[model samples]
Target: MVMSLALISSCQWKKKSSKAMRRRRGGAPEIHLDLLIEILTRLPGRSLMRFKCVSKLWFSLIRSRCFSNHYLTVASPPRPPRRLYMSLVDHLECNSMAVCYNPRESALLLFTSSSSSSNNATSFDQDLTLPGMGGRNMKLLRGLILYIVCRRACIYNPTTRQSVTLPAVKSNIFAQEDYRKSVLYFFGHDPVLDQYKVVCIIVVSSKKIKRITSEHWVFVLEPGGSWKRIELDQPHIPTRLGLCINGVIYYLASTCMSDDIIVSFDVRSEEFKMIQGPPLVSAFKPIDFIEYGGKPSVFDHTRLRRKGLVELWVLEDAGEWSRKSLVLQPCQMHLVNKYTKWKVKGTTHNGEIIFAPLLLCSPYYILLYDVQKNDLRKVRIRGIPKHWFRKPDTNLFFYFEFMDDSESIMHLEI
Candidate 1:
């Protein structure tokens, strides 16, 4: 009887194994190219990039013009209401948390507590950790984060846990001393060419008033090949690196002690040309680059007798830089004065310009300036001691970088 039971179990196991093999042979259902693209479009950018390696059909589909147009159309729709976060250092230096908030939610609550004297500090959310982040200059480009650490750069998609490290750049071309000089890094995606480009500026510093040197590097993210660095005639050192609007990277350069010049880099042709800025006002603060109304815009600040005012400029014509609209309004100087010196920290998704007031201020407050409607709001985290922004305990220093979600995906797509 025992032998009979054992034989019966063995036969059952063999039958199960045979069924598994049959299923394996049957394989997954064949998905048509259009159907595959529809499903692929639903997946995040990083997943599509990985799917390229799955099969030659997938590679052709993803790299096709129709796929790119559809991807951009679906991925970059009308801006959703977003929440911004800034990291706060806890007792452990390495362990930090971030506070975030959705401005739309805040607006709903504002009407209920309309008479409240408190400056709507409750809009800010609780703490979140800065996980999987290494020291780097990060930029948000089209729903992905681009992080640059040392000589290496990567595109990280936090939502999908997908990251692609770019190939190491050739360090031998630039001298060690030249590398130490102030350099501007800009990352962007050009759908026209279906490629990603990382632009690096190597500026020559001089203590003398009239002396200047121009040195720079351009690295293209080619398909299959590693990042190829292209040498170019050096333009002036750009004060601020702009985003890619229509296949070009715009930069604001200080032409003279008093003049500011807008320069642009063509990703396809690898050329540099100058654009126009706003009309000059006495004591004009340099314009900060931002994305507004689906195009590249600039935020210019001017203080009239300690009262701060700001203006937004949008590019009306790609060929004619002079064609721009200036929208102006008074700025909240109280919020601006919280930091030691106010600089355009960065721009946010909701057409708000974030200003980092103090260079050394810790537990920093992100000042949000709405260029379209002329409004100012401050985002500060709770439970943070005021002393964090005070002078450091020692002479130690720390650097802060803001990473965007869009640019991160573009790297992996490259």
Candidate 2:
């Protein structure tokens, strides 16, 4: 509806601007370029994409990087009626959970819910389907989603329904039959360059665990893009999914000397730096990365269900961390069940932490905990596919992600 109004307004403005130009001596445009851009920015992506055919000028303007940045800046603010984006990959059989689930066999469902004025109920509607099994390892940034499909790194734009599969990185570790090898891929966008990049790390180790070697590769997402080898001085094993804040990609890794370390890579500079991680870092810890108050934070809810204790670790500087502990209030303690495992999915614009169950079930609901008010409430999600819950004995696993903003209309290059 907003797009329709914007289109109507544009048509009316053009007629008035043309007459004013004729009356002027120099035939100058009555509408300033900035004003035109402001009107176009208000329209959603689908309408703007269709409007590109109206004229060459409109096509070029909408495709420019400067315009994309301007549109993002205008649309990124936290307004009311925020949305929650979720992706679920369901494995129906118990045997599928024991092994690597094939993307062809499983179902990947997308959903979105808008927050009501009362913040009481949220109803999700099914979204576009993609060719991948999204899980906890998947990462969503800006208007794109990054996931692995058949061992290939894939970046998908939900707005455009466009996907780009990155070229495979060549490594000798894959051919080494006697040695164990693992690969990790991270997705990030460079704000300065206005480009998307994928970072690949391959770690190879033997049974002795004495020697470890790794390789790093980087790929820029654009036309005629290819993977290039990069260098890192110290070899470490990445333990978790990468989190990109601003233009830096951060993830947990362990070196030969210490088990807790944070490796940060600058997307624009392509430089790697290591920071001393918090003392609570561990391979088995139940923690998630989130943007809290415009800074990178580690949400540690390992004991939230078991003991009702939650820890927030904020990165203050290079190697400094500020920690705060919050325990669940006695009255709201009933909301948590010790038997049901929960994970910190993400945060709302108002700084509320959303908690989701690890196991999938019918009548899906999520918990919202406001740090400021020290309150907890459950918001039930309606409109999940009925077929998913038809068979009670069927095993299912779900992967969910949330963004506390509206849909992005940014066009992707690849």
Candidate 3:
């Protein structure tokens, strides 16, 4: 009986393996294992996920770490999966999102991990209403987003439609000191360790005592993750979301609130360092922190008379920075004159700067400036739900644009 069962199992395994391999005949009629992997790696993200059911051998190969790395490299050979999401907020705090990827509609977002869910291809533009996630402080790294809050954190991966809400972080030893106030959270990843980390900086200020204290805590994402507190001596309070590169996190911070300094934190070492900001900085002027050509760069709009020019400062090393100036052409300046409250929205990995306006009207368009060619082009985002702008001036709207190009399949592991 045991021998018969063993033979049956062996036959089943052979049958599965045979279906997975496509025997190709050449001059030598060689088995195309490398060719098979090459073809599989070039397939679309969803197509590869669906092809796993072809056989047990195929399923294992698709899910293996080796195959995952190869597929990721192929997908992002030169250009990664670039996705854009635009969020608009009105006077009454009502928010709407513009997704820029779904076919015949806006982009994709807000997925759920339902066992019976066959609706993998979801659309967020169909509905003008936004998610219940409160607060404006958020970070988008790869396809995952962390809505930073000391009280509650919403960590979500839109690619796999998986989400986990982390518990509220403990603020300080004193019960009266509310850690939620002035809470700044930065989401970063250590590519070397393949880990996602959330750095929380909570500023607990007391008016009666005339003093302020800062607390730092970190949360690393894993199967079972928890928050660990770190000792901090620096008095910097970061003002914006950090840009994580390699294993370092860089964000704009301020010690006196009059001038801003760059804060660098190593995610792997859990150490903090400060870099001095450029001179002649003002809050009224349009300044933005962007990743330019794989390094931390700043975009400053140096306004002169009715015309303005943007300066791109790229860091060559820790001590040196290269700066480039951008001025709009005659026709591009004409379009810019009509826009109000426009600012540098984002910068792509290929050094294309995006401009978005926070106007209270429709038929909105964004500007894209190429650094290499020194040319600017405007692209209008269409497919917004009709009901959002149909109300006319009854509702005021302001838009913020974000792009994610870090395409990785690790999110689907859950």
Candidate 4:
């Protein structure tokens, strides 16, 4: 409906702007651009996207940073995004060695709540297979999702259903299998600069050759944006994707010396720094990255098996932390296997930590662990795509990535 109105307004505006341009021709536009922008900014995002094509003038107005910033702040903050998106991938039961779950098929699944305040099961909406060659490294910011396709990255505005691929960095490593094994990606937005950026880390393997090296690169989200390579002296294998908060991206990276070491990259400065990790850094142990009270944090999956206790380690300073332990209730304990391998999917904006079992030993359900109450509740998600649990080839298990993200109307320059 908003898009329809935006289209209607653009048609009307085009008629007016045409005469204004003809009247001024070589002079000032009869319709002041500032006045025109003010009126357009009030329209829905869907309308604005269509209006961009009305004329070069309208295109520049909608894509300008000044206009986007104004549009973002003009309205009351969007009701905290209840829309949830998840990317699920599980290996098939095919003969011989297994193949990658089709990156394009059943790659992304979305669900929307039936009401603003209801706690009942969520209703499934739609599924989207991101464009481009379809590579992993999926991250979302504001309302734009950053994903890699064909070894190159791209920004997608799901609100507008528009996408722009990032320019590929010139390199020979993309052809090497070793490079694929140690690649990590982080997508962040700098509120200070109102800019969206991508941080790519590639760790060179030593056992494959010798003397390993790690490289970093930054890609600004804009037209003609290219990867600008950065330098890093130490080598670390990234275990999970980076989490963005307050313009910084943090993730657990393992050095040969320690598994708790965290590597932080300032999205604006493009600099790398190290911070002390919480005590439980061990090899082969899965670390669930989360956000607690708006600070980056992590918890051990190992704690769950020990009487259903999970310790949340939140980073307060570069090398400091505030720890809190959440104990699962007996009723919650009965919901799933007491010793099942469970992983933290994410922390909700309302200060809740979400978890799901690695193996579907129990029925499909998500545990919402409340931080303040230390209680767990189940959010049963319905309408999951059929492909999600259908393991035609392998019935052993199905693994998926669960993400709790926000919805925004932020427009992309591309």
Q: Which is the leading candidate under TM-score?
A: 2
Superposition-based RMSD of candidate 1 using all C-alpha atoms, in angstroms? 11.4
> What is the TM-score of candidate 2?
0.82
Expressed as tens digits, the lDDT of each residue in 1-414 for candidate 2 is: 555655654554443445656677455444566777887887666667778766667778888878876776676223224456565555432211123566644556455533432467676654434435354356777767777644557776665566677777766666555355677889888988888899999887665546668899999887788888888879888877787888999888777677677889999999999988777666457887776776677778888887788888888855589988898998888899887778877777688888988766778888998876778999887766667666343445555566535455556664
Q: Weakest 10 consecutive residues, lDDT, candidate 1?
A: 105-114
Local distance difference test, per candidate?
0.50, 0.70, 0.58, 0.62
**Which rank order by lDDT, best down to worst?**
2, 4, 3, 1
Tens-place lDDT digits, model 1, residues 1-414: 333432333233232335567588763334444555555565545556656665566567666756655665554322222334333221212211121222121111000111211344423221222333422345655555555443356665543455676665444423534322454577766767766678776555445314345555566655565544555544465666467766778767754343356777788777777665655622236456666676666666654115565556666665433333333344455565622556675676565677655354545465666756667787653433345455443432222233343322232444
Largest lDDT belongs to which candidate? 2
Clashing pairs in 3: 99-107, 100-107, 101-107
- Give the TM-score of each candidate: 0.63, 0.82, 0.72, 0.78
Which prediction has more favorable lDDT, 1 or 4?
Answer: 4
The TM-score, computed over Cα atoms with residue i paired to residue i, of candidate 1 is: 0.63
The alpha-carbon lDDT assigned to residue 183 of candidate 3 equals 60
The alpha-carbon deviation from the true structure for residue 92 of candidate 4, after best TM-score superposition, in angstroms, is 9.5
Q: Judged by TM-score relative to the true structure, which candidate is superior, 3 or 4?
A: 4
Superposed Cα deviation of residue 410, candidate 3 (Å): 1.4
Tens digit of per-residue lDDT, candidate 3, span 78-159: 3323555544322232111222122112212322222211212213343433344323354677666666322456676554
| RMSD over all Cα atoms, model 4 | 5.7
